[model samples]
Target: LLGIARFKALSSLRKKKEDWIDDDDAAQVPDSADTPEVVTMKEDKAAALRRFVDALPEEHRTVIDLAYYHGQSVTEIGEVLGIPVATVKTRMFYARKKLGEALKAAGYDRGWP
Candidate 1:
């Protein structure tokens, strides 16, 4: 029940494009600098990341979404999910490892720009 509510809230938040990038970070990018190629590349990277994250197991994905997308700390996530703090940390560690491997496999070896 709680999980369902949390998932719904996160899903709604995720649907907002403005939530994807921080205001300060967005301000750093000049409108004039977004050449078509750069825009396409950025889109591709975002698509790839979304695909990879979506592929994660539900438990792992939940931890990642709460931590990154919602900017929640490990202790906060543990409380929200009713899991132990160590379990949350473990899930985050494995989630990050899997994401890194997926990105590398997808040819983002040098990491995101």
Candidate 2:
């Protein structure tokens, strides 16, 4: 179920490439302008990051989802998961390390968003 959902989300992201904008480029676009290469680069980085996050181990991914996606603090995550706060912090640390390594290896080592 999760895989299917992720696939659908990624497919939609690819289809709606122009909707993927950084904060600096959020202004309305003129119809006369061509789609810039920078847009493609942003999409590439987004796709790469998504792929890496999805490929993470379940434990690591859960920590990432709770902390980043759901905006949970370490203490909050620990409470929700019925684990110690220290454990939550450790999982987050390892998850971030793995994600950083994966993103760097995919040639998106700099300028995140």
Candidate 3:
């Protein structure tokens, strides 16, 4: 069940282009449009996300890096990691849950959206 949730989350994220803005382009927003506080908030969120991922356990972190950073499918992750697809899914599920909790604790009260 959790694995299914993780898969859905990844699918949703992939479909929602607006949710994943490139930092370089984000920074190019007109000066008149962005307040300094907004810019700082973005930076802080990015930093927190990085720290969260970096702090994850190796097994969980590996699955996240492959799925999100490398754009690998669950089957592909299993192939690369020499694990079963189910195992990959489980790790991804737990990793995403931890990330959501961390973000929530960091003031992203909406959780994973």
Best by lDDT: 1
Q: State the weakest 10-residue window (summed lDDT) of model 1.
A: 104-113
Task: For each candidate in turn, give its C-alpha RMSD to the true structure in angstroms.
Answer: 17.6, 17.4, 18.5
Candidate 3 Cα outliers beyond 4 Å, as residue runs = 1-37, 110-113
TM-score of every model versus the real structure? 0.65, 0.63, 0.62
Name the better of 2 and 3 by TM-score: 2
Report clashes for each candidate as comma-separated counts.
Answer: 0, 0, 0
Q: On residues 19-44, what C-alpha lDDT tens digit does candidate 2 reach at each position?
A: 56876676655566436876787788
Candidate 2 lDDT: 0.84
Q: For candidate 2, give the lDDT of residue 76.
A: 91
Q: How accurate locally, in lDDT, is each candidate?
A: 0.89, 0.84, 0.87
Compare the candidates by TM-score and give the number of the best one: 1
Q: Give the Cα-based TM-score of candidate 1 against the true structure.
A: 0.65
